[model samples]
Target: MSQELHPNGALNQANELSSMHGAELTERYNKSLLGVFGTPSRVLVRGAGCHVWDADGNRYLDLLGGIAVNTLGHANPLLTSVITSQLATLGHVSNFFSTPTQIALAEKLLEISAAPAGSKVFFTNSGTEANEAALKLTRRNVGTEQTPRTKVIALEHSFHGRTLGALSLTYKHKYREPFAPLPDNVSWIPAGDIQALREAVDETVAAVFIEPIQGEAGVRELETEYLRAAREITQAAGALLVFDEVQTGMGRTGQFFASAPVLPDVMTLAKGLGGGFPIGAMIVFGEENTSWLTPGDHGTTFGGNPVACAAGLAVIHTIENEKLLEHVRETGDWLRAALAELDGISAVRGRGLLTAFELQTAVAPKFVSAALDAGFIVNATDEHTIRLAPPLIITREQLETFLAAVPQLLTAAV
Candidate 1:
């Protein structure tokens, strides 16, 4: 038998990885990596456009889009070119300094967000970090020590992030319980309950966090009226309103922001921000809200690095240049309509490319497995809910392939 390879030995054999099949790679993965994410379903080798191939040479349509992060899809020429060019010139700099690419990206974000004068941005490397920074901003709104505004409001069925601070605001027990005694005083009101919100916000509240479309909760959308009421309620009570658009921001929801016009005092973004590159940001609206965080209050080492910012800029420019926003709206409508007519679908919900469909029976897991076997990548958010946040660059013909297979997949699942 061949000698067992140590973890470091495996790392040294990186060149040989391409030759390893899925089973061998998976077995090695289980031995060397932490089990938090469990076993990965496939050993994806490479990708182009909306398609990826496994180590065993299986080609699959990637419908999950790296959980909605690959805004321009895989191997996007523009995104790749910008990132490489920036890296060749100036890849990273200390937070004590900033690059032109970083500054331009922040400016573009403010503009697309329609943020008012004196708005500012804090950069981070992922969605959880963005939410962490926003949480700190809310804490800055603390009143006098005697009557500190410590209470935070988040909707039931909401998901913020897994980090300690962001996790405090998340509602699921399974996610929150093990990390017992999270930042205290976070209240969860039923989503879309205006009266409950009215009762929850008060002078002692620091902030209210909302996700316009709750992606993890099966793409449940909070009505526009409720969003408006949230704005009103938070403003009246002197509590900052925060929109966690980590999954719905960028061009994922057709519009740049899902709750556009109904703006929030603070907005957190990630996922699609840098196409496939990792980047995140927290936008503080208006001069007053922007002043809440000073230089020493927060910072990140690789947050505003030139290459990531360059990637972000390319994503925005491409989205605009290609008129993807309009395409997303049109395509999303077509996909949802088509999904609704599928045999096993019970209901479809979402706006733009961020969508979820409920099954008539609890077969989402089985259906997802069948989908994987049939050369498609999809996500089962729960027993009956399957979410689809395909790459913004995915075409109708690409989506149709999965659509055509759904009937057979559903039957196989049952």
Candidate 2:
């Protein structure tokens, strides 16, 4: 038997839970939530601009930007207002219905992508879902069940998503081993290896997925020459080229899409698409590819919710209005140059705000812990790599503070 509480009692209970400090909240989280993420470093209460306050009332600069999801930073007034206003007007409707906000967002995505006239967009609740939809769309290019173009190519060290279909395309052994036998016939190629891509992609191949900047793989990048070669190879073989720009898109690389001029047949976007709000998009370029996924082929209940679409619009509008692309380019250059000169730093890689540096010693975990203790937030992608993806709005002065403390942080870690 369960005990029932009065409405006021439930409200009070919520208030009490919200008022709890870091340690208590962490304990509650451990008990209530799944342990897949391990223990969170801090129970953050609130955020503003480029900083967040933990439940214990300590402030820390947010350099990871919610793993490159918070495009406009935390608690942005414009984003907040847009979301609230849309919620008040129309929050959600089934996929059977359409909304102005959703239509406008689709139009905007196609425009920014420089997609051809007949290009189309499919909305989803997350990057994983977007990738899943893309996988299905790619399968459409496969001739038929009896004589199917069964091969799909993806780069080694890539992280697509955790879902089964997207997981099949992801190249990590650890992530795939637990799932056992994902969708078959997917081939893994080395990143930026034009020869491997050319050799792998043939008429029997349906599609090839590439991340312009491989964020989870320590900000590894695919060069333009390689991308162009991929385009040519896939085109010659009549296979689709897909760019998974979940991390590098939406002004993260100081551009709308990281791989420009060298376009793909399909592109998937999320992460920063809604500026912290949950939304993902799969843009299929050209008339032929756009027509592949017809009605009833793929559908999502809350994919194109009005509120989420409104949030995406606000993020894009803010980026344009604030001219953040230029800011990201300039600041990213400065930040990378500074990181390269720091002690114990061996190499810096990345374009715009999506950046990472290798440590001389394999103490990235310790370095990250020290950074958190010093009121700065960063991520260790591996034992030797630290990735930084601060909010686009973060200023030079704020980054300078972190830069100044790097030597001391490295010393502490060592």
Candidate 3:
């Protein structure tokens, strides 16, 4: 028989954890909830500023940041305050009319993206909806003639979203095959290959969607010149260049927009835009392009809710006021270097806070399991890839502690 010990030196038999908060809750979840996610990793109870506590009262340094959604960390006071205040004033207004906060957030996005005057915005509740809206816009841009130019070009190993239209653009066969007969006229090309992009994008293509930094593909970042090439090719083909910055936007890539150098005709944003709140926006540049979608072309009931917009405003304010961009650049560089020095890590990829490390062996899941036991949170995006998208507000000391324990954790995992 084995035993577990409490921090206060009390011995507990292994079977005694049946009454623990996490165990009990997990059991309840397994019985009641759908098994879409397989099993709950942890029954987290509360969180604060880059850390969370599980139901069992075990604390963990949250390096995953809700899969890069919790931009300012959990329960940020400024973000919470704005959301509460906005909700108190005006919770939501249908697409019939817009609120001040909603309009302001749109203006902020335009400013951040350096979108030209007359650019337009459409909000959604999540990244998938945003991509869905973009997909519709692309289809509509060329009109629905007998042979409409509705073809879309995307990169392989990329993830756009799960919605039928968005999933059609997502390159994973496993995710796509199960839900076959998706919207047709979509093609995949190798990422980071300008020639592939040039060969794929032609007059028949309606749009070319690329992630400034491919987040779900283990933080694979495409080169600036490649993006420039995409822009030129898309423009020549009269096709819209759509940049999916759902994970790379809002200063996660050390810049306001990871594709700022090569501006796209359409940009889809979500994830960190509202810190932790659910909001997504698709900004289309060029007045002619914006004019393609007239009234009734697209709409969302709760896309730009005042409360969500307020949360987004607060997140942007905090980032600018606190100068977190500079911190992300410095800290990300430091963290990359530190992780590279680890014995088991073969390479590090990505920019700013969105990072992924390649392991020496295919033990990423084992490493993630060990990291959980070691009081840290990480994600195994693939068998050999560990993605780390910590809160931009994470302190140097917090990351240093994680760094110090990396070698030991890797050894134990291997």
Q: Judged by lDDT, which candidate is best?
A: 1
- Candidate 3 per-residue C-alpha lDDT over 154-264 given as tens digits, one digit per residue, 9 for 90 to 100: 999889999999999999999999999999989999999998898887777899999978887889999999999999999998889999999899989788789987888
Off by over 4 Å in 2: 1-11, 144-147
Q: What is candidate 1's lDDT per residue for 221-295, written digit by digit as tens?
A: 999999999999999989999999999999998999999989899999999999989999999999999889886
lDDT, candidate 2, 1-414, per-residue tens? 223565456577666876898899999999999999998999987899999999888999999999999999999999999999999999888998999999999999999888888999999999999999999999989766665798999999999999999999998899998998789999898999888888898878999999999999999998999999999999999899999999999999999889997889999999999999999999999998888888789999989999999999999999999999999999999999999988799999999999999999999999999999999999999999999998899999999999999999999999
Q: Which regions in candidate 3 have their CA more than 4 angstroms from the true location?
A: 1-20, 143-147
Report clash pairs, candidate 3: none
Error of 3 at 258 (Å): 0.8
State residue 24's C-alpha deviation in candidate 3, in Å.
1.0
Give per-residue lDDT, candidate 2, residue 2: 25
Candidate 3 local distance difference test against the native: 0.89
Question: TM-scores across all candidates?
Answer: 0.96, 0.96, 0.94
Residue 203 miss distance in model 3 (angstroms): 1.1
Q: After superposition, how far is residue 404 of candidate 3 from its true place, in Å?
A: 1.0
TM-score computed on alpha carbons, candidate 3 = 0.94
lDDT against the true structure, per candidate, is: 0.93, 0.93, 0.89
